[model samples]
Each structure stands twice: as structure tokens, then as C-alpha cells.
Target: MIRDALLFQLGYNATLVTLGAMLLGMAAGVGGTFLFLRKRALVSDAISHATLPGVGLAFMVMVAFGGDGRNLIGLLGGAAVSAALGLLGVAWLASRTRLAEDAAIGAVLSVFFGFGVVLLTMIQTMSAGQQAGLEGFLLGSTAGMLRSDAMIIAGAAALTLGLVLALRRPLTLAAFDPGFAASTGLNVARTDLAMMGLVLAVTVVGLKIVGLILIVALLIIPPVTARFWTERTDHVVVLSGVFGGGAAYLGAAFSAALPDLPTGPIIVLVGFAIFAVSLLLAPQRGVLSAVLRHRMFQRRVHLRQGLLALAQGQPIYEPLTLRLLRREGLALPDGVATPAGRARAGKALLDETRWQLVRQDPSFEAAAAHYDGLTPIETVLTVDQLDEIDQRLPQPHEVSRP
Candidate 1:
């Protein structure tokens, strides 16, 4: 069943629904990248929550006007309007009042969500609302979705993604340095609005698949997961879209294959699963890589200290250092230095002497300031400088023997 769903052989409506879910996920992921970069992730939460009242009101108006209260386009249009108002309110409060952006987001999200719940309750008591299924918008329900509805969702998602792509360069510039972007003739305010507009489109379009609440997960998790794998913003946007699309596609297939499973929660779970894998396994930024790098550095430190000890004729007291020296064939089990160890030790001692002489020399002050004991002295000094420093050294017979 799972294989059939993945292969898109799961009947016409199911296939369309899955495809729609994937496009919506990609749109959410790519559009949300700028919001994530701008540190306004909470705004998505506010906008999503703010959408509820619009949906309830739109339903009420449709019923009052003798139209289908469950019309997808009308409901989504209402949601977009309400979400826009909520966004504007947040901006106004943050910019014109004493409240911080987060406080404004909290205010808008709570008030609008509370009003929406009230409207939903009122809707439940109405005769026409008994079988409305409006509650599905809160957590998304793709069960019995029609082919036309699926196509609408997929089309809207694609449009949103294209707009995000078209504005990528300007958005990227604004994201990193708004001041520089402004100086370079990019309207920072317009760029922010464009970003918010894209986010709003994703939020509205995703209502039927991921729902308002779970849509925030769609918008956020992909970008964060992508960030674990890259340092470049463009790369992050691309990876985020891929991750989001894959998660949604797989999640929808899983939901279709398994009975009594919901699409929204399943999609969210899949996104988090991707995040977990990236966090633990990404090459440069993952926890496993960090641990390996640390271990390598520790090994280098142990080997360096062991060599210096051998050169000084000191007893190897640290067990790990001694074991490391033995593993490298630089020492014996009895802590005695091997011939190769003695040779390495001489070079290590000489390097140490050169560093000390360079630090003590007034002429080498510039080079001496960069000394971090692990750096080779040769890299710090030119050949001429080394020769000059060497001239200040004592004769070979004057050097102490081990």
C-alpha cells in the first residue's frame, strides 16, 4: 500500500491530494526562509492563528448570503484578509507603540484566535453548520478531498514558490544587511512586506492540507533543518524546499497507506524526523562531526605533549598520552622513547627553542604576537628572519645533551 501510494497509483483523488501537499510544503519552506533569517518566525504563528477568525466569519457570511459555507476559495480569501489585518496590526504595534514585536505577536495571535474559537462555537450551534466540517481547517483533513480542490492547492503553492524565487536576490540582500540594502537602493520596507506577503500566501494556501497550527511547522522546520547542512543562504533555501517537499510527499503517502492517520500531524512528524537526522549527521555542523573533530584535536594535543616529554627525558605519567605514543610507535610499553621518537623529540625541542628565541627578540615582535603554541615557527617567520634568529643561537657544543 505504501509503495503504491509513493508511486502515485493510489487512485486519482489521492494522487492529486499528495501532489498538492508536496507543493504546499515546498512553498511554505522556501517562503519561510526569509522570515527565519529575519528572526520573525513568531510572526508566522501569529498570522496562522489570526486566520481562524476570518474563516469563521467567512463561513458565517456565506451562510447568511445563501452560498456554500464550505467554499475553499472563499474561505481561503477570507483567511488571507484576516491574516493581512493581523500582520498589519502587529507591525503597527511594534513600530508605533511601546510593545515589542513578540508582545505584539502574542497580543494579535491570542485575540484573533480567541475570537475565532468563539465564532466556531457559534457556528456549531447553527443549523447549516452541523455538517460544515469547518473544524478540519485547524488541523487539516484531506480525507475525501476532491480533484478540483487538490489542483487549486497545488497551483497556488507553485505560484507562491515562483514568487519567492523571483525575489530571492533582493530578499537575500535585505536579510543579511538591511542597512546596506537600503543604501544600495533596495526599499527595505517593501522587501519586508514582500516577505510577509509570501509568508501570508503560504499560510493561507496551506490551510486545507497542513492546517493553520501545523503550517508553522511546515514553514519553520525545513529551514532550520537545512541550516544544519549549509552556511550559504541560497543553499539553505534550496535544501529547505527539497526537505519540505520530500517530507510532505512521504507524509501524505504514509497517511494514505495507513488507515485512521491524519495528514497534518503526519507531515509535521516527518519534518521533525528530517530535522533530527540533519542535526545528528550533517557533515560540517552536525553533533557527530563536532565530536570527531574534538577527538582529532585531542589526539594531536596528546601526541605533541608526549613528544615534548620524550625530548625533555621526563617520565610519561599520563596513561592516554603514553598509549598514544606507543600506538604511533614513538614509545615502548615501558615508557622508553624509541629511536624515531628521539628524532621527533629533537625537532620538537628545536622548534620550541626557536619559538622562545623569536618571542624574546625585539625585532620579531610582530611575528611573536601571533604565537599560539601549536603553530609551527617556520610559518610565522620568513627564511631571512629565521636565519637572523638562528645567528643569535649558541654553538652546537654549548647545547645541553639529554
Candidate 2:
């Protein structure tokens, strides 16, 4: 099944559609990084929802002009224009009005999508709209995608990819620190608009593959997932593209094999699965790794504290000390610290001094003046005494050189 899906044995159409989906995913991933960085992720959602009316209106206009109502170029052109207008409206509402960015985005998204639904309804009632197949734009159906449609999507993807590579340095500067970028004579606003244009291109191309509704997932999930694995901007962008492309390819292949599944949702699900795995299993940043590191730190602290007690000649509970020594691998089966154990304990003591957790050359005589009863130095030291000891300790820089 895998071989058939990948090798075009399932059919040429399936192969073409899968390739188109991959291109769409790659472009969306790269463009989405800027959106993610700008904290404007929801703007893409708004833009996507806003495109629906354009699609419906385009279909209606085509029918009015006595042209094919399902013309891909005309519908996509409408989508791009409406999406851009939606973004402008969001920006205007945010800047000119008191509405917050989120509120503006939400308002534009809902109003545009509602208007689109109305237009779709109006089209459905028209005589020529019966065969429009416009509903595919709403939830996506790759079955209707032709070779020409795939070619157009490929072209848009190529353009988006090229723009991203050409503008990477400027885009990175703008995304991270627009104020600094502006100080350096970069037109932050123009750079932002260019990035948004790339996003619009990808969104427009992705509509036929994942539909507008799920296309935002292509822009969001992969980039976020890639973030878990790296800190560098370039690495994240590259990984995000790889993850997005892989998800699209696998999802399209699976949908092709099943013939009953929608490719858009499947692609989203596949991307989400990758995100889930990364969240749980990725190094350093993953949940499991973080938990393990926390546990290891706790155990090391316990062992170090036990070693400190031994170094200071303070009486420690034998079982606790033994346990710490065993865990640190510094004790034999007899539960006694060997020479190696003593060396490790000395290292722990040095670390404690470095961390300022313990004082060097603590004066027991000065500390005991505050306590009445005859208690061990560690036990008798009051909080005030400990504070004084901390103050009297040689500073890290003042300590004698080795």
C-alpha cells in the first residue's frame, strides 16, 4: 500500500495531487513562521475565513458574465483580494479604532465568513450555480483538482519559497525586533506587508488542497512543532517546512488510498500527530525530558547535601546518607564511602561553595553566641547566625587561588 501510494501506482492523478499538497505545505510552513514570530497567527485565520466570500462572489460573477462558474483562476483571484482586504480591515480596526488586535481579527473573521455563507446561499439559488462545485472551497476536495490546478499551485508555491529565501535576513530582523530593525533604516511596515503577501499567496494556493478552514493549521502546527526541537530561527524554518511537507505527502497518500477521506483534515491530523510526539519525546524541551532532568537535579541535590553533612562532620541519618551514596555510585555494597566516594564528596563540597550554599571557614564561635543550648553547629545556627556566616564568608573572587 505504501509503495503504491508513493510510487504513483495508485494513479497519476493521486501522485500529482500529493506533490501539489507537499508544495502547498512547504510554502505555508515557511510563510507561517513570520506570522508566528509577529504574534499575528490569528491574522492568517482571519484571512482564510475572509477568502470564502471572494470565492462565492467570484463564482457568482463568472456565472453573471456567462463564463464557467468554476473557473479556478477567477475564484482564487477573488480569494486573494478578499483575504488582503480582510487583513487591511483588521489592521485598520486595530490602529484606528479602540478594538484590540484579537477583537479586530475575530470581528473580521466572523463577519467575513458569515457574509461568505450568505453569498454561497445566494449562488446556490441561482440557475447557473447548480454545477459550480463551489462547496469544495469550503471543506476542500482534491478529487476535482486538475493538472492545470496543480501547476498553478506549484507556481504559487515556488514564488512564495523564492520570496522567503530572498527576504530571510530582512524578515528575521523585522520579526524579532522591528524597533531595532527600524532604527537600522529597515522599513518594518513594508517588510511586514511583503511577508503578509507571501502568506496570502500560500493561503490562496492551499485553499484547493486543505481548504481555507484547515489551511491555517498548515501555517501553525508545523512551525510550533519544529520550535520544540531547535532554538535557531533558520533551523526552525527548515524543520517546519520538512514537517509540513511530510504531513501533506503522507496525508494525501492516505486519503488517496482510502478514497473516502478528506485530504485536508487528514493532513491536519498528521501534523498534529507529529506535534504530539515532539511534545512528549523531543530532547531538552519535551515533557518527558524536562521531567527526567528535574528528577535528576533533585537526586543530585540530595546527594550533595548528604556529602556536605559528612564534610562538615555533622551527624547524618545513616540510612539517608547510605541511600545518597548508593545513588551517586560512591558507596560499595558495604554502604561505606571509598576513596573515590571521598573524592566525589570533596567535589560536591566545592560545588556547594561555588553555589554559595555553604560558607567557607565558618566561625562556630561567632555562630554559637546566638544559641543558648549545647547543640551541634549546624543545628544550633539560627537564621541570623546563618545570615552572618553568609556575610562573613569570603567572596567568590576573594577566595585564595589554587
Candidate 3:
């Protein structure tokens, strides 16, 4: 069944739902990058939560007007309006008052969500709203999704993605350096509003697929996962989109294959799965790679210290140090140094003495600062510098005649 869904053989509705989810994920990832960069990730949470009131209000309005309150378009439009208002409220509280942005976000998120819950409760009491299935907006449900709804989702997602791509430059600049952008005649505040607007659009459109609560995961997780793989902003954005799209595609397919599964939660879980893998395995910043690098650094420190001890004729007491020496053929079982060990020891001692001399000399101050005990002296000093330092070494005394 999973294979059939992945192959798009689960019928037209399943295919459209999966494809729409793909576009939504991609738009969320691309749009969320700026939010993450700006350290405003919580704003997405606020915006998403704030959509609930809109959904409820839209439902109530439709019911009051004698129409079924379950129209996807009307519900999404209502969500957009509510999210935009919420975004504006956060901005106003942050900029116009003494409250921190996070505080504003928290207040808005709680208030709007609470109000939405009350609305939902009220909705349940009404005969028309009882079976409205408006509860699906909390997480998400694709069961019996209409073809027109799927088309709407897919087209709106594509439009969002296109706009995000078109404005990537200004958004990227504002995120990284609003001060500099302002100096260059860009309106930082306006750019920020534009960014929030895009986020609002994504939050509203995503209310059906990932829903209000889980959409935050769709917005934030992919960019975070992408951050583990690269340092460049452009690469991070592109990789984030790819990861988001893939996770959503697979997640939607999984939900379709197993009809019991909820679409929103399944999608969020899949995204988290991708994030976990990236956290553990990406070479540049992954946990496993970091551990390996630490071990390599520790090995270098141990070897350097052990070589210094050998050069100074110090007793090797540490078992690991002795084992390391033996493994490198530098010393014997009894801790006796070999001929090769002696040669290496002499070079190590000379290098240590040279470092001491350089440190003691005021002229070599800049060069001496690079010494980390593990860094080779040759790498720090030029040929002439080494020659000058070597010339200063103690000359062998002439044997006195008896």
C-alpha cells in the first residue's frame, strides 16, 4: 500500500494531496529560513496559533449566512486574516511598547489560541457546527479531501513558493543585516513586515495540511536540519527546501497508505526524523563528527605531551601514553626509547627550546602567539627566522687540554 501511494497509484485524490503537501513543505522551508535567521522563529508559532480564531470565526460566519461552514476557501481566508492581525499585534507590542518581542508573541499566541478554543467550544454547541469537522484544523486530516480543495492547496502553495523565491534577496539581506540594509536605503521595518506577511500566508495555507499547531514544525525544522550540513546561507535555504519537500511528500504518502494516520502529525514526525538524522550524521556539524574530531584532537595532545616527556627523560607512568608510544614504534615495552625515538625526541626538545626562545624574544611576539604546543614550530617560523633562532642555540664547548 505504501509503495502504491509513493508510486502515485493510490488514485487521483491521494496523488493531488501528496503533491500539494510537497509544495507546501517547500514553501514553508524557504519562507521559514528568514524567520530562523532573524531569530523570530517563535513568530511563526504565534501566527499559526492565531489562525485558530480566524478559522472558528470564518466557520461561524458561514453558518450564520446559511452556508455550510466547512468551505476550505472561506476557512483558509479567515485563517489568513486572523494570522495577519496576530502578526500585526506582535509587531505593535514589540515596537510600540516596552514588551520584548518574545513576550508579545507569547501573549498573542496564548490569547488568540484561548479565544479560538472558546469559539470551538461554542461551535460544538450549535447543530450546524457539531459535525463541521472543524477539529481537523487543529492537527490535519486529508480523509475524503475534495479535488477542488487539493487544487486550491497546490496552487496557493506554488504561488507562495514563487513569491518567496522572488524576494529571497531582500529577505536574506534583512535577516542577516538590517542595520546595513537600512544604510543602503532599504526599509528594514517594511522588509520585516513583508517577511511576516509571507510567513502569515504560509501559516494560513498550511492550516489544512499540517494544521495550526503542527505547522510550526513545518516552518522551523527543515531550516534547522539544513543548518547542520552547510555554512552558506544560499545553500542552507536551498537544502532546507529540499528536505522539507521530501519529508512532506513521504509523510503524505505514509498517511495515505495507512488511512488511520493523521496527516499533520505524521508529516511533523517525518520532518523530525530527517532532523534527527542530520543532527547525528552531517559531517560539518553533526554530533558523531564532533565526537570524532574531539577524539582526534585528544590523540594529538596525548602524543605531543608524551613526546615531550620522552625528550626530557621523564618516566612514562600513564599507561595510555606508553601504549601510544609503543603503537607508534617510539618506545619499547619497558619504556626504553629506540634509536628512532631518540632522533624524534631530539627534534621535539629542540622545537620546544626554539619555542621558548621565541616567546622570550620581544621581536618574535606575533609569531610566538601562534604556539599551541601541538602546532609545529616550522609552520609558525619562516626559514630565515628558524635559521636565526638556530644560530642562537648553545654551541658545543671545546675540550680543554690537560
Candidate 4:
């Protein structure tokens, strides 16, 4: 009967926790989609880690005010302050120094987290009468969440959603091409700040469920995975929310089932599992798409090679059969391989391969007659191109030049 009661309570609390986490994750997914597009995903990481100190400070303030150690208001107050300070520091560092965005993010994250650790340790030692509940903010004890917490999360989620809807146009335009956005009269800097602030808020909301250590997973993985399923940004945002929220719900449920397991890590792992599956199977941007594209490209390359040799009046592989050409998608209409087909296929292949090979050889010209076939009679890989390609090859996967 005790076990049954515990299970029932667990189920109820789990549902509440999942609801809170889903609200948080949905906001994160929507906001983070823009952040990822803006190439500011690392900023989300910085804010997530930086919020730790704010949480610690909030607890300290609550204790000073004679409030209990488990005050959710204190925790969130601290998180907001910490996140705000971290953002200011990042902005100041960028303005004062030549450091890049990633470097600035890393520096702020380390400084804030280190400070949080010290504050937490100090509070733990000094507050012997009341056991510090601040550590839960670091690892997220969703099982301990209450109705108040759910309400708070729901409010924040609503605010975040409203902000995203209001700023969608500016955010989208800025993310895709900021220069163009600026030209069209959007205040790129303001748009950036607004979007980042939304991300920070979402991060704090998630911190109570997933903690600072793994919150970036919530911000990045879902949106990235969703991108594979759709080309349209609106659909991507919606799908990303579903993916993130669903993962949060399932992860919270699983964590409730296993007493020894931590909720934060489980949530992160669940999110990653979704991302991995999407990466392999999503329609456009999945691993399977890349693999198929590569195979098709390779076939065209082989056909181009054959056509090039023919154009140069040089010898190709003895008895280059129609089957060989067909395998490369360079097959002629009949059994006989035509120069035109071979050339066309070869040209298409070169265009496709350029993405993966551009840095290696600037002078690697495709066939003039067929980008797939042969370059002009005198055109060949230049000496400089040969040297560049040689130097650029991956150390363990070097290809020899003809």
C-alpha cells in the first residue's frame, strides 16, 4: 500500500513536473530556434551556466530575510540577476577586447560558474540550521517541484511565447542575413538583444528541471533535429517545440520511475537521443541524405573521369562497359555510351563535389563540355591547385593526384 501510494504520488508529481518542463522546453525550443539560426547558440550555454550564481545569491538573500532555504522565488530571483550580469559582462568584454563571440561566451561562463560554486560552498557551510536547497537548482530535483513552481513556469513560458511571436519577423530576418535586415531598417542590435534576453529567460525556466550543466542540450538539440524535417522556418519552430517538450515529459517520467537517477542528465540524454534519431532520418538534413548525396556524386565523378580521358584521346579503363557508366548515373540512352551524356553527368557531379572540395583546390576545373567530363584541352589541375589540395587533405585520408 505504501509503494502504491508512492507510485501514485510519483505519477501525479511526474505529470506536474513534465508540464512545467514542457512549458519551459517549448519556450526554449521556440526561442532557441532563432538563437541557433543567429549563430548564438553558445550564448545560451553561457547564460545557462551563469544563472547558477544568481540562484545561489537568491538563496542567500532569502536566508538573510529569514525565509526558508527552499524558496522558489529566491532561486528565480538569483537566476535572473546572474543571467543579466553575465550578459552585461559578455557585452562589455566584446566591446573592450578583440575576443570573438565564442571566446567571450566561454570566459563569462567560467567566471560566473566559478563564482556560483564559491557562493554555494560558503552558504552551505554558514547555514547549518537550514539545509541549503540551492544545490537542487544545479541538478534539478523535479520530483520536489510544487504547484507554485508549475504556475511560475507556465507564466514564464507564456511570456516567452508572446515575445517570440511579437519579434518573429525581426528575428527571422536578422538570423538569415543581418546585413540585408539592417538595410531594410531593422535594428539588428536591438533584435539581437531582445532574442538573447528571451533565450536567457527560457534558460532560467528550464534550470529548475534540467539545471545549468545540461540546459544547452534543451536549447540546441531540439531545434537542430527539427530542422531536418522541414525547410520552412515556421514548421521547424513548431516541430522543434514538440520534440523538446515531448522529450522533457518522457525524461521526467523516466526519472520519476528510477529513484537513483538524476533528472537533469536523463533529460539531456533523452533530448540527445531524439537529436540522433532525427540526424539519421530527417528528410533533408539527415545523415542519410548526406550519404545518398555523396554516393550519387561519386558515380558522376567516375563518369566524368571516363569522359575526360576520352576527350583527351587518352586510354580509360580497358573496355569501359555501359554497366560501369550506369553505376555512375552517366549511362547513355542505349548500350553505347555517348559523349554528350558522359559530359553532362560529369559536369553535374563536379558542381556537387565543389562544396566538399572547394578549399583544397581552387583550380580544379570541371570539364568545359560537361562539368562532369573534361576541362578545356589545355586546362588541368594547376601546380598551385595540386599543392593546395595536397596540403588540405585530411592527414589520414590523403588522395593521390594523377
Worst 10 residues of 4 by lDDT: 369-378
Clashes of 2: 0
Choose 2 or 4, whichever is better by lDDT.
2
Mind giving the per-residue lDDT tens digits that candidate 1 earns over 110-226?
999999999988898885526888888998888877788899999999999999999999999999999999999999999999999999999999998888889999999999999
Judge candidate 3 against the unseen true structure and give its global Cα lDDT, from 0 to 1.
Answer: 0.91
lDDT of 2 by residue, 1-402 (tens): 766986668777778888888888888888888789788888899999999999998888887899987889999999999999999999899999999999999999999999999998778777552567777787677886788888888788878887887898999999899999999999999998898888888998989888889999999998899999999999988999899989988888888787678888999999999999999999979999999988877665666666676566555566755687876677655655667777866666654443343333444545435332212345555677567555745676877878
lDDT of candidate 3 at residue 44, scale 0 to 100: 97
lDDT of 2 at 109: 97
TM-score of 4: 0.75
Q: Model 3: per-residue lDDT, tens digit, 1-402? A: 999999999999999999999999999999998899989999999999999999999999998999989899999999989989999999899999999999999999999999999999889887652588888899888887899998999998899999988988888899988889999999989988888888888888888888899999999999999999999999988999998898889999999999888899999999999999999999989999999988988887777778888888898888888888889999999988888888888888888889988999999999999987777899999999999998888765855668
The residue-by-residue lDDT of candidate 4 on 277-362, one tens digit each, is: 98898767899988998886766466566654444444555344345665555444353446565575455444344424643334
Ranking by lDDT: 1, 3, 2, 4
lDDT of candidate 2?
0.82
Residue 142 error for model 3, in Å?
1.1
Candidate 1 backbone collisions, by pair: none
RMSD of each: 3.7, 8.9, 3.3, 11.5
